[model samples]
Target: MADTAGDSCQNLREESARAVDNAKQLQDSAAAFISRSGTEEQSLRQRALAAESTIRKLRSSLDASVRRGTVDVGVAEKIEEELCKAGSIITDGDVASFLPSIDHGTFLKMFLGPINVRATRKDVQLKVKEEYNRYRDNTSFLFLIFPSALLLLRSWLWNGCFPVLAVQLYQAWLLFLYTSLALRENILRVNGSDIRPWWIYHHYCAMLMALVSLTWEIKGEPNCAHKQKGVQLFLAWAMMQGVAMLLQNRYQRQRLYTRIALGKAKRMDVVWGETAGVEGQLWLLYPILFILQGFEAYIGLSLLKTALVGVVSEWQVIVCGILLVVMAAGNFINTVETLMSKSRFKAKMKRSKSKQELDQGLPPCNSRLK
Candidate 1:
């Protein structure tokens, strides 16, 4: 019995020893696995950081190349020369005498002279001139009629003769005028002309409409709901048309200006180093204009909404806000392009002037000669 008991104890001790050894082996394996995983993770992080650094260096190099190589240095020099010449010409004459000549007709004659049909055989130039003339004529007509129509509307409304109809008609007329002006401006831009007058007219019309609307709202009784709804619809339609006009104007103007500048440079036997900058400037202006249009749209929409629903919704406000942001971003890009082009152009001009001075065996002037 004693021997049998001793044998059982020995078997149990052997079994326990085997179990402890297996546990130790498993623990060692687990430790090894953890150490290897940590090392691999650290290596991946290092590699990622190295890759990012290389990308940054590459991006910087690319930016530098674009700024120095892609930019038109020659064009910038030419613009500088032209500006100098213009400044001297203007300064030589009596300032007071030249002030009156700053009118649209005179300004156009001088500035457009370089790229006139006589200088270049470009179809675009002719188209631009035609468009500009049309805009001028239309604007003149609007100016002549708007005031008289407003007076008539005012009198009719005061007399309470179909007051709602009179108000609606007046609003319709204003809408038509603004819409026409916006469209003409866009067309002029497409033809490569700056429609500054149209821009001014649109703003003026908007202001006038707002005032008139406010006045009518205050003075007249809320009797003609149907006519008021019609007026609201007209305003909305006009606003939509205006936005479309602005978009078309922005894109067409950019193309037209770019082409006109190029044509001018080619005709004058001059390279504009600042073409990129000018383009960038236009890009910047575009976004700003877009934002402005968005704001205008928002205002018009808000007015219409209030008139219709008697309340403005959060969603509408959010939509307007988003549009404004997008417009601003577009403008920022445009501005950057213009500034860069201008800088490059100026640099090219300086280099050309320096070369000229050296060739002539003359000292470089510190200031540009007026």
Candidate 2:
């Protein structure tokens, strides 16, 4: 009976040990599950934070757009899509495991959304055309008249040799004639006006002027100080003019690209209708001209200083110096104004994009996000 009791007690102890082992296995499984769940929760929280930040950035962008007075519906939709996707990644179980595929181009498109939308508008096209026309007319007039007046004034003031004055006058006249011709070509291109022989005449004359200027620079004899200075000025002017023409061509090409990209018109249509060449010419011309003016200013200042220290008259030096200063100031102002306008336009575009995003229920992004 005692032996039976001892065996029964030993069996009871074995059963208790088995129970403890089963409990430990259950506890281990629970601990592992809890650890995995905690990690997933942490990951989801991180995703939520990221999504919230993106949404906020999008919202800010939208607000900027409203101030710019332009609407971009497509951009708004895109922002909304991004927001939804991001939100899903944060809240949805399976989706949370995957990262959103974002890229620089995608972000850039979003940032420039307003510009893309506005560029597609018919009214915007019309406005751009009108502005181009106005610019062309003003530029043509200035190019035709200003150089002629400057030459005439120089001739009158300098009392320089007849040959020098004659050469300068002839060059000025040729420049004016070519500019008029270029303007006509440009107008024809824009209005679908008939092309005329005058267009060819202007192109030929411009090429002739360029060749003549180059030849004169190489072959002309400078017998006097005045003659030497005049030749130097003329050479500088000619070189700058040629550079301007090249730049103008590039500008026109860029403009054509811009128009096509904006879907305002076809490249062929614009090319056929407008003398994009003139636009290119101006683009090349202005910066070079500005630089030339700056150089001229420095030259004038140097001349003035030399005159003061030497036998030359102070009055003549002062007058030339003043003219150079005036030209430099004018060029500087024009350059600055142009830069400012471009900057303002870019800012407006940014604001417009932001506004569109905001309208679509997205938060604006920080300006620094881009």
Candidate 3:
């Protein structure tokens, strides 16, 4: 019995040593892999920056010529259009080809869903960009349509002229849309998008609210009193959001286009539409945004009160109310940041243009020259 015990002890010691050796090997391998990944990321980003710098130099030359009155405004814009093509080529060939697949891209494919079949890392990133563009376009359209329809036909809707079944179906549609958009945004973040984390959290919150609201009983007398009023309020919220969406869609696209033109952003596969004309429009947009934000806050507070007072004591309502307030705050903050940044950029550009003209033996303005 002693001899048998000794042999068993020796075997266990050998197994333990082997396991430790294997673990050490794995640790070394993981460290080496991570080092290689960092090196590759650094190299690729440097190359992209070099290419971007070259593009910016060319754009600046054209801009300078425009400021000096040597190039026609229309001609400079055309040149910019051509330069956008060059930017596209570089993005596709140089940058995209070199990028590594991020962890979330693989996770996205494994779990929720992928909108496209992406065989390579570049393919995944491109697909993410494409899907995001499509999602934004869809939302812009839906926000306008649903809100306008609800508002224009509110009286009829209140009287149950719109079938409960139809309303439910529309809500389902919205739920699907919001959920898909959130997933796509996650995938985009994985693909190197600079989307704020707060926005992503906001989407998650919205999806949860949508899901909970779907379970809301919109018909029948048992719980119809408060429930129906909630639905009506929701419609009004949607209408307010619709106006905000339209403004954001139009203004933000133009801002993005301007950024791309200035070489601050990678060019997208879309036309640079008519100029934003934002200089004279801030008075209109800001007030509208402020009103919308206030309204959203009021609705969220009301919902919270109802839930807290046990007027409609579903846990989902409580959670959704909290989420609504959070989302509204996030939205407002993001909007303000964007507006401030754009305003600063425009001011700087104006100052630079004026300086350039002065340097070129021209006055800052006709009145100044006179």
The TM-score values for the models, in the order shown, are 0.29, 0.34, 0.61
In the range 283-338, model 3's lDDT, one tens digit per residue, is 67777776776777777877888878777777766776777788778778876876
Candidate 3 clashes between residue pairs 3 or more apart in a chain or in different chains: none
- Higher-ranked by TM-score: 2 or 3: 3
| TM-score, cand. 2 vs. native | 0.34
For every model in order, what is the number of clashing pairs?
A: 19, 29, 0
Q: Write the per-residue lDDT of candidate 1 for residues 125-155, one digit (tens) a residue.
A: 4555555545544544454454445445545
List the candidates ranked by lDDT, beginning with the highest.
3, 2, 1
List, residue by residue over 120-157, the lDDT tens digit for candidate 2: 22344445555544554455445545445555654696
Q: Model 3 compared with the native: what TM-score? A: 0.61
Ranking by TM-score: 3, 2, 1
lDDT of each: 0.46, 0.52, 0.68
Ten-residue stretch with the least lDDT total in model 2: 95-104
**Among these predicted structures, which one has the highest TM-score?**
3
